[model samples]
Target: MADDTEANRERGIFIMIYLDYAAHTPVCDEVLKSFEEAARDFTGNPNSPHTPGVMAKKRLEEATENIAKILSAKKEEIIYTSGASESNNLAIKGIAKSYQRYGKHIITSFLEHASVTGPVAALKNEGYEVDFVNINKDGSVDLEHLKELLRDDTILVSIACVDSEIGAIQPIDKIYELVKTKPHCFFHVDATQAVGKIPVSFQNMDLMTLSGHKIYGITGIGVLLKKEQIMLEPLIHGGLSTTSFRSGTPALALCVSLESALAYTTGHLEEFYDKVREKNLLLRRALEKNKNIVINTPEDGSPFILNLSLKGVNTNALQAALDEKGICVATKSACCAVNTVSKPVYAMTKDKKLSLATLRISLSHMTTAEEIERFLDVFLEAIKG
Candidate 1:
């Protein structure tokens, strides 16, 4: 009876410790309030010509301007989309389709999220030549090889600002300088894992992708920042809307939520980052002493994510063990978690053993010191048992 009660306790009633912020974050209170208010007040279609529509349009424009200001971009540059996947698809495929006359070759890193990878692959199938940039053992982009890969015919170069698997922050500034050597080449960044958690600049970026859910906003909204000079072929075609590139009715509630989330995140970014950085350091210091664990995240990368490979411990089993104790972690991107294969870490390092044992522990400003402590205690016991 005592054992039964203990087992039930292990699997029940405990407050869950959510450590998967990179996968997606819960909508914060501020963003939720804005969404609720928008739903109640802005009920008209933004494109309609009636007074209610005009009011909705005004509010929508304000949200767009707010997001642009936070990112240091022009209001006209922001293109709203369903999420990062759509934004990535539009940016990659749109550029390839529109600029084929200038060039047919494109470049990207092997460490990109599947959203970026899938669109690039589709482009390859459509007869465009694609080049993948390799990463160093530490997961940083190989700048020398990238320099060699550039040519007069290279039309676009896409790289992730922050890699999701290993949390390696790419040197976008240096990459921008290199890609500029080819006058016709445009640069795009899949910044799903970078924005809000770290400082991002659009000075050198021709196109960049952002997702609202990743920043504690609604799940269905995303933003693509495109330079006014860059031309993109329309991915969706229908009735004319505010922009010709993507044709669809925009969700006003989602826009309001995304704008509010960004305002909250960027307004106190330094404070939020500093707190998470301290937690990251605490976790690293605690695990570094264990000879059986290998830490893969770069020391200078974003502090919100940590990657580890545990020797002699099955990663799938450990994840399950932690989940049973009301702690949530991940073995890969949430989108690819169920697959038995691990690609990103293995491709970056070519270490099969490390990849199979990989675990991703992501933090957020909402994470508490007590949660971290509890995680370490539960994790160590699971590994030992």
Candidate 2:
């Protein structure tokens, strides 16, 4: 019976439709090919002084230049890290430790990914005061409360450019303007979810984080965009190679892969968004036909993610049903999926039951209309059962 079950599971998975792009995306064919070719030729330490190392160093510099061009930033401002989580940690903890003399107050929203919250939580235990800005039902940050929370000692304000759970795009420009009143404060944005799907600007941002995996690049590689004047205490202590802030030998292949990923996405971003937007609309319309569901993502939110609650249904069971049907979705961040509840969704609705039933359906540019239609049929059947 177990052998039969395993075979059945494998068969079902073979036809699965992936709708979890916000969690992670497969590296594009172009990026993979570029990385494979570069890895074959550029296998040397970027920090080494040998001839082969010089070739690796050149590749690193070229990748940095390309990434900076995509982000509208200076090449020198980019500091590579393992991924966005580390970048968030380095940005938040580094600033808290280095700039606390200026002020010990830090502010962030409840909708932030765990990476930001984990570092902020650690600082609270060390005597730094943290204010968690609340969000409206639509998942947009409460600007009035954020303005009220600012103080002379508020040295850093970190906000996610887009909420990965619900795909709500925060008004960073306005937040940047309001934060300017504090004089000593610096603005940090986690653009992990928004980078490839939407436009991200560094106009008034002091620090920004990006993850390569989220944009169809290789895993274990990311970028931290820091303004030239902003100083941070080093998180990793070693010989400085990439930037004075992060110490380690750079992964030359990963850098080249990330550069390729960013260039491909940005080059076709508008066209990609249009296609995904249509798929999102189709999914939303199908869900609307079932009054047993409530859409949580705002209409103005990014079309890449659609969050909804299945009334009178258990989310764990729903997830299992979807899995058996070879459909992939998420209840929250894949990082926090082990927990039974979604803190971010609960923070937005303040309704435990609604949060418990929430499902995140994320789309990619490659999503097809047939996949959305099939998902709707299976979803309605599962709810009825």
Candidate 3:
């Protein structure tokens, strides 16, 4: 997922058909209110021992416990980081560095966001033997192939609960079953795209990462849930703050906002999901008729995201055309457009041209049927030429 601030603001769109919720979302009004109140009332460093600091620390812990409760994790397991990128790095590098003596092999899939793939690549450079797990044609992990990749020496297996590009939900529980049989292996999941949109279970995961902005919370804060027995080398080294794993002044307001956002998202998850499903089906039915386009999303993919590619058209051009007419969509992840090709699409379809022409039109509960209709009209018009 990416930032909404980058939603073609340069085009100065006053009216927008924002089909890019998978990239990022607007902050929830209630979550924003909670943040403002926290900022005003809790104005002390949580690390300080003063009265104000004590009060602030108390609220921060309260927020942490609230977040942990919602995720079915222990309060002590929550580690706040700058965002999901930092959390992914901390989990991947931290675990690899901490357990290198036990094993040097790691496994992941092409469906992971840049955060997971980047850290895994960094580990590869540092003499860790890394393997790419094969994914099914629908963009889900090929568990049979994962079993082949698993070995006594495989230390970490990191995959996302949902692929942000294709919205394919992975079989985390089944995968965890395979990974845990190896005593040295640790299972990690980047649930950034799955948490609030769907019911994400923390059952068999040793480490999990989630972003606040992806769930209508404040942007700079993210949560990483680590099991009690897992020891990770600290990514940030300094005086202890909330946890020894990552160090910084506790973000009182962001923490409050995160709690509020999760509460709201989960409280009405089924409502939001069912509504988004209708919009997804509407778009899918309309888009499927275009012979020049190929739909990449799976039959059982998350309704919040749809991936497709134009047969001969350059996706960036279509994206720009849509932007010019007040529609916001994504050619790739917010951070990955420069790559100019969709790696996930290639992995799913094995067609180089289609991968190069992919566009991701993501939906959200906030989306209206009118917006989808407007988008289809504009999108079809733009591609006609």
Candidate 4:
């Protein structure tokens, strides 16, 4: 542990046990290798007309095809972007802009990532009506409230497939059934946290967003999967690349890494999920042994995230203590940055103590049992102190 601490310190911040996979994952070695190889051989602009460019374009095409195969979607339906933020921006704003004439109202849940919320807020500023559905005490979106809000003027129904702060898995199938019954409304899912951690079928989903960095892939690349018949106005336009949806030379190397990572996760998902569940259960049981601590994550929530509240403990003090002991976790969505208050998801749960004193311990396939045990040791010591 000392040697690990030294190495981590040399790397910048020292956190021996990194349990914040929901925020972002370290790139897998295999994905890194593929990224390096692609960078070396496919450096040409994918949209250029030269031989090298043609080769790079082919690599991009292959990568898109591979990822589409994994998602069971058509290649043309996949649009590459810088990351999930861009994908969500394009999906929400593009749809809102394109379909504005048909309807000016859009419905979404309050627990969505800032990427989605920001766009919806911007749309509201521009005179579009945006209605947010309430979440249940367990942090799940209320589908009945959504159904009540649906109207002929509601052009889109957007929701996060998984609550990033609380780890509650939304019932997308049930939401889809409700939305599908409304012929005028299109369904979009921000599946950034759910993509690799949970099984997702795009069969009933019209639009889905995925982030590469969340699934051990290289950062700066993401995918927006759209149904074949769905159309949205282009977000960025200039070059002829990306079928005019997005313009500019595609990141061939990043695309390759993202595809490879997704394929690897899809193949080993069952084993990985089982291991993650075992580790999470171990940590949860150990943490619960302390009568003062409360488990906040739903029992049936995604296996990778554990949200906890330490009674009579200040979150900042606990966080500092954990950091000193070389444990890394977070208090809220990393997207919101450190030191920020809890998100709407926590607020909706109505457990004020848990909401404010919460800590999120997110896991990954690479997270080990030993790391989890070490975390509990440090956590208990911190709480006691």
Q: State which candidate, 3 or 4, has the greater lDDT.
A: 3
Better of 1 and 3 by lDDT: 3
> Mind giving the per-residue lDDT tens digits that candidate 4 earns over 235-273?
888877766688877888888999988987888999899
State the lDDT at 296 in candidate 1: 84
Candidate 4 root-mean-square deviation in Å: 2.2
**What are the lDDT figures for the candidates, one per model?**
0.89, 0.89, 0.90, 0.85
Question: CA lDDT of 376 in candidate 2?
Answer: 86
**Which residue pairs collide in model 1, if any?**
none
C-alpha TM-scores of all predictions: 0.95, 0.96, 0.96, 0.94
lDDT of 3 by residue, 1-385 (tens): 1134256465554566788888889998999999999999987888889999999999998999899999999999999998899999999999999999899999998888999999899889989999998877878888899999999989999999998898898988999999998989999999999999999889889999999999899899998999988999988898878988988888889999999999999999999999999999999999999999889999799999999998878778888878877789998888784546788888888888888988999998999999999889878888888
lDDT of 1 at 8: 67
CA deviation > 4 Å runs, candidate 1: 1-12, 337-341
Model 2 over residues 259-334: C-alpha lDDT tens digits?
Answer: 9999988889999999999999998888888888988888999999999888888877788778867788988888
Writing each residue's lDDT as its tens digit, candidate 1 over 1-385 gives: 1224346676774467899999989989999999999999987899999999999999999998888899999988988899999999999999999989989999998788889889899989989999988888777889999999999999999999998878989999999999999979999998899889899999989999999999999999998999999999878999656587888887889989999989988888999999999999999999999999988888988899999988888888899878877789998887775545556677676888888888999999889889999899989888986
After TM-score superposition, the amount by which residue 214's alpha carbon in candidate 4 deviates from its true location, in angstroms, is: 0.8
Q: So what's the TM-score on candidate 3?
A: 0.96
Best-to-worst ranking by TM-score:
2, 3, 1, 4
Deviation in Å, model 2, residue 215 alpha carbon: 0.8
**Can you give the lDDT of residue 192 in candidate 1?**
90
